[model samples]
Each structure stands twice: as structure tokens, then as C-alpha cells.
Target: MRYHACRIAVSLSLALPLAGCATGVKSQLEVRPWHSINEFRDQRFADVADPWEGFNLGMYRFNYYLDKYLLIPVVNGYEFVTPTFVQHRVSGIFNNLGEVRNLTNSLLQLKGGESATTLGRFLTNTIIGLGGMFDPATRFGLDRHDQDFGKTLGYWGAGSGPYLVLPFFGPSSVRDTGGLAVDTGITYGIYTALDPFADTGHSFAISAGVASLEAVDMRHQQSFRYYESGYPFEYYMVRFLYHEKREIETGKAPTAN
Candidate 1:
């Protein structure tokens, strides 16, 4: 009787953790067992359609650690050392530079009004605002129409593919990823064509330095941090919210059913 009881006790202990981990599925098991692995996964993550949950979860943890240990400290130091006015100027410069992307995308989307407004803002800010250190164009009533290639693709009815958690860029879809590459290529080509630093003979160094500053400024402007919501289901929530937000902004329905 003692040996039989020990075996029962061991079996119960082993089953308990698996049962706890199964959560909602265990209750459904009473009705019927899962039909397939896909069915089991679908039920397990019914709240979010995360087919790549394993990889996405890994990237999420990686981003959290990277932000906490490296990016946050660097951004903090930048903010601490730089004056507010200087920071504003830096942001303005980057915003001015981004107008190229905005203008190109606006043209692609056939947004005549937005393209004109973006062009006016770019010219006004670059020439008058001294390379976008100031935003006199906003005061002059030429509002910025921030557009990107991703939105352009969406505008043309391109479906957002699977959810992706990029190494540096974080949450993005397959369509957006491709759009980003195209936009980046366009910008790089334009920069190469203009070659503003050609005369200095240190174009590469100058470009690298500017790129680094732009990266830091970008990080400084963003206020989001990983796990900041204090929710256990933050990953699923973020994934869902990102998809919904993109759908609304792009006016394109998700095609990844």
C-alpha cells in the first residue's frame, strides 16, 4: 500500500505543473482533446495571433535588455548633457532631413496637397530655418505631412504580412520591412547624389558622425520603453495594438489571416 501511494503521489506531482501550464485548455479537454498541434497553439494564444511566438518572445526579451542596459543609459546621458534648446535644434534638423522621405512618399501616394505642403516646409526650413535648426515653416502655416514608404505601400492596397520584431527597429510587419528597405535605399541614393561633404574630402567620416547623432536623437525623441505598462500580457498587448494601429493609419486591412 505504501509503494502504491508513493507512485500515485509522484504521478500527481508531475501532472500538476503541466495542468497548471495548460490553463484554459485543461477545461476544454473535458469536452474533447485538441485535434492537432495547430489547434492547441490557436487555443493557447487565442488572445493574439502569434504564429512566431517563440522567436518574437526571444526578440522582446533581447530588446528589453538592450534598452535597459545600453540605449537607456546613452539616451539619458545625451539628455543630461545637452541643453533643451540644443536638443530642439537637433530634432528640428533631423525633422528637416526627414522631409525628403516625406516628400518622396507623398508624391508616390499622389497626395498633391501634402506633397506641396511638405515641399514648402522643406524649402522654408532648410533655407530660412538654417538647415532645419528652427521650424519657421510651421509658423508660416506649412504643416508637416510625415509620410513613409510603408504608408505609401499600404495606401496602394498592399497587405501587411506577418508580424516581425526587428533587432533594432522593434515591431514591424513584412510589408513595412520591405518598404523600409526601399525608403532607405532612396534616401541613401539621394545623399550620394548630392554629396554635400565631397569638397571636404572627409565625406565618409562626416556622414558616419551625422548618422550616429541622428540615431541618438531618434532614441531621445521616443518615450516608449519595454515592459513599461506593468502588464503580464504586455507582449500580446503590444503585438495586437501595433497591428491595429498600423491598420488604422495605413487604411489597409491585414491580409495575414
Candidate 2:
């Protein structure tokens, strides 16, 4: 029973980062020539390296339903009750906390400049911005530079092994999934260390509540809706785009033919 409870907790944490990096695609269905679903799927995925296509597709559909039925409704309720200023402040706090992950990964990659910038941003936001309720770092020209353990691995020549649509987490590669675990561990450690309620018996409950709020804020910041792209082969497009975007960001973009 404990094991199952732990599994549920883990799943909820992993699934909260939905659509954070996804881009919406405008449809060409009205103007494009007709083609059967099979033909379109086959043609678009012909050269893709998704060996887990069947599993990935199933998970993709599962995520769509999960977002539609569970996540979005909660997000709607959060927006309904919270004022806009409060929403932005919540988002800012989370983003400021994210700088910890970014700073760690940048240092791992030996990116001296990026590490310094990230550190500066964290200090500036936390101190001057009042617990990250505002972003003063950007105004000072210390732009937010996001980094992750996955990108650090890629920088050191680790390949993105397979295309995967993680349950609740959405699109990821094998490398990024592992990176996510490492980054999550880092964030969890910070939460534990800085927990103001640690001396109180309610630390666990407070932590859970904060985590839930962070998840909702993440979804609130995202605007992409599944299947709203209006492309018949959206799964294919998203898969391809995800791979390409990661490659470019990690400086491993494929050479032009």
C-alpha cells in the first residue's frame, strides 16, 4: 500500500509539467489535399526514429484526455479565484526557484558565463524582487538562461536515445527523462532544506500544497491545447518538433543535407 501511494505521488509530480514547451500549430486542413490517415501517418513518420511509436501514440492520447478532463479544470478554477496579480506573483516565485536548477546545470556544463548570470538572477530576484514576486533581473539585463541536466549531458555528447511521450509529463527523450529525475531531485532537496514549516508537524502537508500550487501555475503559464492545432498528424508533428527543438537547444542540431 505504501508503494502504491508513493507511485501515485510520483505520478502527480511528474505529470504537472504538461505543455510547458509545446507550440501550437495552425491547420492547413482547409487548403491541403485530402489523404487518408494511414497515408499521412506513414509519410510523416517515415524517417523519424521513434521505435516506441505505438506506445508513444497511446501515451499522447492519454495525456490529451488527462489534460482535458483533469488538469485544465483545476487550472480554470485556480484562475477563477486568484486575482491576476497574485497569479503572476505565484508564477514568478516558481520561476525564481527554477533558477536553482538552471544554475546547477550551467555549472555542470562548465558554462562560466551562464552560471554567473543565473546566480545573479537568483540573488536579484529573491532579494530585490521580494521572494521572486517580481523580476528585476531581466530589467538589469541578466536574462533568464534555462539549463537542465539533460542539456548538460548533451553538451558532453550524450545522445537523445528515443522519442517518448511520458504520462502526464508529455514529450521527452530518454536522455531528458533521466535529466528530469536529476533535476527533480535537486528541486526536492531545496524544498526540504528551505521548508519554513520543518519544525512544525505540518511540513508534509504544507509541502504538498506548495507543490500543487506550483503545478497549477505551470499549467497556467502554458497556452497550448492538445488537438487544437487542427493537424491530422499532430502527433507526428509534435514528436518531430520536440526532437528538433531539443537538438537545437543542446547544440546537436543535425547538419544540413
Best by TM-score: 2
Mind giving the per-residue lDDT tens digits that candidate 2 earns over 144-228?
9878999988999999998888987888999999999999998888767788898889998988898899888888898778887
- How many clashing pairs in candidate 2? 0
The TM-score values for the models, in the order shown, are 0.78, 0.83
Residue 111, candidate 2: alpha-carbon lDDT: 90
Of candidate 2, the 10-residue stretch with the lowest lDDT total is 17-26
Model 1 steric clash pairs: none
- Residue 83 in candidate 2, Cα distance off native in Å: 0.8
Model 1 weakest 10-residue run by lDDT: 1-10
lDDT of 1 by residue, 1-257 (tens): 01123433453355345535666565666645333334444532244446687898799899899889988898899999999999999999998999999999999999999999999999999999999999999999998876788889999988888888887678887888899999999999999999999999999999999998998888788877887654345566567566766666676534656
